[model samples]
Structures are given as structure tokens and as C-alpha cells.
Target: MLKESTELSMILVQNRQQQLNGNKRLFAWALVLLLFLGACSPKTRVLKSPDHRGGNVGGTIPKEEKPEGVDKEKTVEDARRAEAARNSVALILPFQLDKISPRTLLKEDVNRSAIALDFYQGFQLGLDELAQEGRSFSLNVVDSRDSEVRNQYVAKSEEISNAALIVGPVFPKEITSFGTHLSNKNVLQVNPLAATRAREFNLPNLVSLTPSIDVHTKAMAERVARDYKTGDVVIIYNTSDNDGRQFLNGFLSELRKVNSSAQVRSVSSVPQLNEEISLTGTNLIVAGTTDRFQLRSFVSNLEAKSSQEYYVFRVYGHPLWERIDFSIYERFGDFRPIITAESHLKTWTREAKEFKENYYSLYGVSPSDHSYKGYDAARYFGNLLAKYGDNYPEHITKEKFEGLFSAYMFDYNESWGFVNKAVSFKSYQGSSFQLN
Candidate 1:
């Protein structure tokens, strides 16, 4: 099942050499490797031991060869001591290796495994950096297969039981299922990707890295409240969909908290919203729908109406608006829409440039959002483990990190565990979106 150390330099070097042929070939090679890796059975792949030296090793931990006169008890004791001293971290991801078949493998299959592969590569790079800085860790990578039964089984494994920190099981349902089976309440399980609210899971030891939708709503609402004026009217364009309504409700609740008497109205159509807008005062338009079609239609129609009448307005959009290409719509720029982003990597910055260079050098490809997230997660939590040992969770709230993609400032919730409150608000300025 490819139980191996994080010493992936040899493999990377070989891949990089092949990549020099052409960019197209390089990507093809990467996909091929991903498919190959995904064909393996789910098993625990252990990183190299702190004491290990010389060549890279793979497969299951070999049986220790004892000398004829060596005392078995003493050897066992020493092994236990070494294990106890070294920090153990486990990463549980849905590689879904079983889904890949030799005869039926397609580009779609490779794409399915890409998220796990990208994250793993970035995570390995982070660990490599830690190792270079003289931090020792025993990393265990296990495939969750995105199965509830599999998660339950893996949760009870020795690797999970011994781990000081567990990094994944990416989806919300998987996180809940895995957490349910985990017996060790002290071990911190990180929800690396999911944007689901922490309170829903009710996992006391869970650390949610992604800020929830409610956080985005509150952040946007607070910004609106801060800049609010007496004559300015706040109008919400909401849909009947639960997601749209959730943002609408959350924003209203937070806005009311700051300005109890704020002039606010909710409308379902562009025409109704246009009627509420005044030419004299600034109209704060909150687009509460995450649906791309509705957003496009609403924005286009409102922009046309506003431009024709010369109405003063600014738009606040749902978090999902980050996915939409507003630049494509010629009228969107005029609205000067502001939206919440979970993470924003300034690629022009020195740190980002170096990260991209290093990532490309090693993986022979550009880093994706998952890759950045993985690197940050590994580096941040690995540092915490090195500094705080088993008591890392206690210090999580106190430790703040600004990584390549995301900035983390956790607030400890007694019921929901550590929830990252960090969120970025970006505004459409000139040709592109910039941090507000």
C-alpha cells in the first residue's frame, strides 16, 4: 500500500527530469503517478524515523533483527521510549484508491485524486522544511476512502490512537464520523477544508481551519455597520434557497447588533430593489444568493437600471461570489462589489513567489488552493507540536499564524472547539479584486 517516508526527493527529482521535456508531458506524468498511487490499498504509510539515516525506505516497518545475545525486553523498552519521545502526527485523507482501476482509469479519475495528491505534496514539503529546521516528526498518512465504515476502522487503529494531531478526513460528514470513533479526546483533529460551522459537528477537540459561512456574513455585516450613514439604505437581494436565506438572516442579525435602527429591506427581484434605491444617498446592496445565475442576472439588471437612472450604490456579495468571474461582465466593475474570501494569496509578494518557485521546482507544477492550505496546515500545526508537545491544543487560541494563503486566529468554543475567525474582505477595484 506504499508505506513510505516523506523523503520524496528521489521521486521528485526523476519527475522533474521528465518534466524538462515539455509542460504537457510533465502534467501527464503527474496524472499517471496519481492514478498509480490511487490504485494501492488503503494503509498507513509512515514517515522516516528521526534516528534513521542513509537511504530512503518504503513499505511496512520491517521487523527489527535482534542479535543472538541481545535482550528482547531491553530492545522493546528502548523502542517504546523512542516512540514516546518522538511527536506522531496522522493525516487521514480520502484518496479513494479503490476507485481507480487499470482498465477503466480516465482523466476524471485522476482529477478525483488530485486534491489528496496536491495536499499531500504540499504537506510533505512543509514537513521537509520542518525537518531541515531540525524538528523531528513521525508522520502517518492513511486513506479514509471517504467511507464511514473505513473511518470508524481507521479511528481505532494504533496510528490514530498514538497520534498527537490528526489532520484530515476532509468533508464534514467524514470528520464527524471519524471523530465519533476517536477515543482519545486529547488528540486534536483538524478540519482542513470544510467550511461547515463548528457547532454542527459538536466535536470538542476539533479544530476548524476554514472560517464558516456565518463568519463571512458577520464580517461583511460589521464592515457595513462601521461605514453606515444616517441616509444610506441597506437592501438585501435574497433567494428562497436555504443557503441564500442563511446569509440573509446572519447578516441581518449581525447588522442589527451594531445598528438597531439601521434602515434595511429585503427584496427578491432586481426591479423591487431598484425602486428602494435613492439617487441622493448611497444604497448598500447585499446580494444574498450564492447561485451564480441569479447573481449574474441580478447584478446585470441592477447595473443597467442604476446606470440609466444614475443611482449611487455599492454591492456586498456572498462568499461564493469569489468563484464568479465578475470581470467578464462589463457592468460588474461599476458596482464595486465587496465579498468575503476565506484566503487570498498575494502571488506578487516575495514569500508567495518563493513558495511558487519551490513548489514548481519540486512538483513540476503550479500550486493549487488545496496545496497552499496543506502547506499552511502542516507548518502551523507541526510547529505547534514541536513547541507545545502534547499540550498544543491549549496554545492553539494563543498562536496566530499568517500563512501563504490563509491567516489563522482561532477562538476557542467550549462546545465547538477551535474555530478560526480570520476572514478577508475584498473589493472589486479597477480591473481586479483587492483586499479591503
Candidate 2:
């Protein structure tokens, strides 16, 4: 990863040096980036703090330029637009082949063979697709070993001279570091994971690809208000993770928005399902965890009370929902529960399918949350490199792109969380997920 970053730095520096002879296009785009998104930070500062922000407020403003010919003006506008439409991104994951750790992910034959790399695989597919479209950008990738070492690596790896952006380092600590000290020069950190652990709420430069858990919770609450009107809403969660906090916050916020007087309850221990008394009136259960202890408890409790009148709503606080060992239909036993899945995956791309199939075939299993998420991160970053070309003189403007497993959009909020935010309902009909 260090070597790759260093190589990229050399290339970017060379480009700038070559362009100093008078490359107006590159200079113009640089001005746009430096002006709108605070891209003017010194290269050393950018490296130290990849999540740096507080600039680029002016990029959204329109600047009219009149050129010689009608054809020339149109060409200039198109070029600028193209630069704006595309930019580079980075995806830091656990894929450092040199250093291997069992705790790192995909270590076991089952997970390694299949699951842990799905997201990256899908992300790679997106890269190939972008190349086909003739848009290319450079992608900086690193593996955090899912540990503090990765944090140190990220903290110091900001030396990439002209990197446009970064997409990951899946852990929140890493994200927080980037946010707290965005030292990357002329580059932005596009966090695709680390959704729940965001301590810094709004950094203008860092962009989160996942929708805030708050968004999901609020959306679910709104839906219930629209459909159920008034009822019993229960939120089940693993109190251990901070991710639960966001979900609860969002859910509670929405409940008040829809009906300030709505009743709310939170439970951490699944075994305490017994504590949950009386299913009178409209009953709604929302579990904020994907823990086996909770899922099993939920399954047993729900099944035992299959005859009760209630609505089972499972809110996947994150991809943790996928780790569940229980089958939705069997656990609920004919009960139709609404499953909320948050993904940045584009879902319907040729490359996505290929990646999925290849992943399953290679590992003899389906891709795990870590794999698919990591893969998407990589592909998204790669797509940026493809679009910007080798010169990278043009500053990329924010625009939405259709990713393999989800749609990604970036705003100045600096939290990539929203880029992957889309809520879709999945009903388990005893066997498979049926979209309603």
C-alpha cells in the first residue's frame, strides 16, 4: 500500500511539473477544486488529515466563461462538466496480502474462499464498467487489518501528493482519525464504511457513502406512521455497539416527528424477550442487532408467540444484519416482518452479478458483509481513477454514480454514510426475500 501510494505521488507530482509549462485546463480545474472544496490544503496537511474539510464552499457557484467560437465555448463547458461529473476515490480495506491475520477477515476457508471479499469484488466490477465508459481515475487502496495498525498507517499515509480522494479504512476509528486530522494534500476521504462510529458529525470535506442510521430509523418510523398510524413500536438492539445509538436516535426522532406522543421501548438482552409483556394494541418490534444471541431469542420468542397479533420489523443497523444465523421466515414462523437493508451497492449491474457469482464459486459460499462492502469501496475508488485519467489535473466535482450494489452520492456533509443510503423493504416468505 505504501509503495502504491508513493508511486501515485510521483506520477501526480510529475503531471503538475509537466503542466507548469502552461496547462490552462489543469490549472483551471485546480482552481475550481481549491476554491470550492478546500482542496487548497498543502499536500503535507492532506496526508496527515485525509478527512480535512471547511473549504470548497464556492464550487457550487456558476462561473461563465466566453470563448472564441461557439464550438470552442461548448467544448470548454463540456470539459468542465466532465471534470465535475467525475473524480477519484480510495478504498482502504483488509486486503493487504503481505500481512495476514486470522482476525483480519476472510481467513477461514469458508469466509476467505467466499464472503469477506464480496464488496471489493463488486467495487472492482464498477471500475471495469467505468473504464468501458472511457472514464478513468486512480484508486488508492489499503488494508487496516481491522486494527490500530491500520489507523497508524492511515494517519501517516497521507503523503500521496495529488490524490483526489479516499473511500475507506472500514473501521470508525480510522474514519474519525481522518475526520479529526484530514492531512491529505489536495485529496478527500470518501468513507464507504465506518457509518456508526462517526464522532465528528459534519466535516465539510469528508463524504460518507452509507446513509446515517438516523436516516433509516426515521424513514422506518415515518413508514409506520403512514401505514400503521398508531401502534406499539419496540426497538431491539445490542447495547454494546454505538451503531445502536444512531438507530435509536433516528427512530426516536422520527417517532416524535410523526407522533410526539408515541410510546417507545428499548431492550438489549434478547433473553429478556420475556420482559416484553403484553402485545395489546398495535405491536411493532424493531431489533437493532444482528447478534445470534438476540436473533435466536427473537426467533424463539416470536415463534412461541406466533399466534399473537404484531408486526415484526427488523432494522439492519448496518450489514451486521447479514451475520444473523436465524432464517427470517422460520424465526418469525409465518409472521411477515419488514427487513430494512442499507446498501451502497448498485444492485443491478452486470459486473456486480459477475463478482457475486465469482465470489461464491471461489469460496463455495456467499460473500460476507465485509467482503461485499470492501469490494464496493474498492470499485468506487477505482471508478474515480478511471474517470479522471492519468493527468488528474482537473478537479472532480460531486456527482452521483450508480454502483454495483448501491447508488452513491456525495455532499459536503463529509460523511460517506448517506451515499449508500437507500431503504428497501424485504419480506421473508418462508424461504427467500420478496421485495414488497
Candidate 3:
């Protein structure tokens, strides 16, 4: 079991790096952290902290650019006219309708349905919230789990073809395939989940709801450069794998943009990592390994080497650390680990509290992080569609959006279509995460 888990971890790391490099497809399973969500019991919990603001506010504002061939005056005028008419937003999800029947279904089938239903529930809430703001739009949900023939039928269907905004078609192949059919359309095609840079496809209207790898890595690098003195930072990475090398190189590139002389080190194993012993100065360690075995060994070695000191041995680690047994490594007060996040769930806020309560009331179970993500994505785009009409993509990067669970700041990359650049950092403080 441990070997299987570690193997999966390595694959995930490789997949993430491939997506970042535009060499391979993004890890589609990332949209649903199935194991994590399924293992936890459904229970409502609130985070009570002496300091209400847990983490550092993380957001990036991209410089606005004029949408090519778009006449601004005419677009706004058309938007105003659209406000009086009905707009449609289509959601394509993997509901696997054909598999669900009178026969006993497999465990995977049930789980997929649960995830889709949760996202739908949250999306409906977002629509309701938008409706309250005097914005009206027709909701169209399409199941992407059907046969490729049906999907092709959906691509040409009026429900999708006429949508002011189209969300989901979760898998990369599905998204890119749908995009191929809608290539000439002016409608917005939203990759509502995952961090995939579907660059291989020639999709002009494509945009992702989640931030990309470049955004997260560059943001984390910028944060480190801003917070700490250049001389005190050191990035330690594994040199054995392509993913490790990619992360190490990308992080160094971003760090160099801020501090040209920032130091870096590469180690393939614990034996190679034995050379470091500095403890007097405030040390910042940026770990680049995403493999479970490597991380476990690295943390164990670092933890064993630590001693009491006024300044802690601060580690800026990978997000996969949260999925593994990271709590055991946080035993010493002198050692701290920080992980970057696309969203930080604020349980104390009124909006969050109400959403959770309402979700629980409706489903009889506590919502997972994906639910919050779904709601935020729906609300953010819905608001823009209401104001900007079919040309919402033109003004999407114009304003900063502070969502209940995330902050939306978009930048249109010619090579990778539109990307969200907002990123948040969080540290495990006792039972919940605090902004770092």
C-alpha cells in the first residue's frame, strides 16, 4: 500500500511538472482530491483564532491589455443590451449517467457522482447569489461522461453553442475536443477546475478558473524574495527526477528576478543532504521534491538535525505535503513549513459560515474544498457575464476579485490562453491553516 501510494505521488509530481512545461497533459485527477475528501467524515467545523486573519493576503494583479479586434465602445453598448435579455452558462461535468442503473454500481461510480453533485450544489448557490444581485442567467448542465459521440453531439448542440459562458468538460481531452468545435465562437470556454495549461490545443477562448503552475511557483518565489533577505535564502531540491529539476529550475528563475545572488543546492538523497549544519541565522529552505518517499526522508533528516534556536528553520515545501503525514514533522517549534494554496477557506467569515450551514442543510453533509471552489468560480464569472455580456473576457482582468475562498486575477497568455495568477500561502497552525 505504501509503495503504491509513493508511486502515485511520483506520477502526480511528474504530471504536474509536465503540465507546467507544456510538454504533457495536466493531471486531470487533481480536480478532485478523491482520497482526501472521501476519507474525511462529513462534519461541520469552525476555526476560532485569536487573530482572525490567519494568513498573509496573496493576490497578483495583471496589467490589462486591450482584447484584439474588439471595439470597446461597441462591446459595452452590446453588454448593456444583454443585461435586458437572458444569458446562458453551460456546465459540463462527468456525471456518468449511463453507468448508474438498477444493478450494483462500483465504488468509483458512486464517488464520481458525489463530487459532481457537490459541485452542482455549490454552483447553484453561486447562481442564487448572483440572482440576488439583480443578475439573471439560464443554467444548463451537461454530462461529459457520455460516449464521445454524445459529446460531439453536445459540442454542436444549441445549449452549449449559444452559451454566453461554458464551464467544465473536466478532462483535458474533453475540454480540448470541445474547444476544437467552438474554435471560431466568441463565447468563453472555462476550464473550471484543475491547473492544466491545455496549450497543445488551439483554443483561443479557453480560460482556467484555477491558477496555473507558473503562477503558483512564481508567486511563492516572489513572496520569499519579498519577505526574507536575499543572503539568507537557500533552495534545496532533488536532482533525480524531471519534476524535481523543473521545480528547482523554475523557482530559481523566479528568485533571480528578485535577488540575483540567491543560493541553491541539489541533493538526491539523505546522504547527499548531510553537509548542512548552520543553525544561528534564520534559514529559509525551499524544498523542490514532490515524491512521498523523498519528502518523508527529507523531513525526517531535517527534523532530526534541528535544535532549539531563536530563529526557526523555515521550510517552503510542496502542496503534496498536506496529503502525506506532515503533522509528525511539525514537532519542533524551531521548524516551520509553509505550503502555497490557490484558495484559503475562511470558516469564520459570515459568507463561509452561511454557505456551510446551507450546504449541510441541503445535503446533510459538510462540503469539501471543491464545493467552495465551484461556488466561487460560478459567482465570479456570473457577475462578469452579467455586467460585460458575451464580451466578459475582455474586462475579466480589469478588476480584482476577492472571492469567499479564492482571489481571481487573470492574465491572458498568448501561448496558454487565459491564466489565473492569484495564489495564497498557508501554514498548519494547530487544527486549521493560517495564512503565512
Question: Residue 119's C-alpha lDDT in candidate 3?
Answer: 78
TM-score of 3: 0.75
RMSD vs true structure, all candidates = 5.9, 14.5, 16.2
Please provide, for model 3 over 1-436, each residue's C-alpha lDDT reduced to its tens digit, 9 standing for 90 to 100. 0011122223334444333221122112322233222322221111111222233333643436444323454454355335523467778777665565424444555566666656765776677666655555666667776345556667887667666788877777787767777644677788877677646555767887777666667887886777676446464655565546655557877877997776656456677655643445556777767776777777777777664434346777665545655665566334566777877777798988999886665444467777887888878888887777767788987867887787888887666577778878888676444676
Provide TM-scores for the models. 0.85, 0.56, 0.75
Highest lDDT scorer: 1
Off by over 4 Å in 1: 1-9, 18-85, 102-104
Ranking by TM-score: 1, 3, 2
Cα lDDT, model 1, residue 129: 74
| Superposed Cα RMSD, model 1 | 5.9
TM-score of 1: 0.85
Among these predictions, the greatest TM-score belongs to 1
Model 3: residues with Cα > 4 Å off, grouped in runs: 1-85, 103-107, 146-149, 200-202, 239-246, 276-280, 308-312, 330-333, 431-433
Q: Assess the local accuracy of residue 299 in candidate 1 as a C-alpha lDDT between 0 and 100.
A: 77
Better of 2 and 3 by lDDT: 3
Higher-TM-score candidate of 1 and 3: 1
Global CA lDDT computed for model 1:
0.77
Clashing pairs in 1: none
lDDT of each residue in 364-410, candidate 2, tens digit only: 33555555766555555555554455432233335455545455544
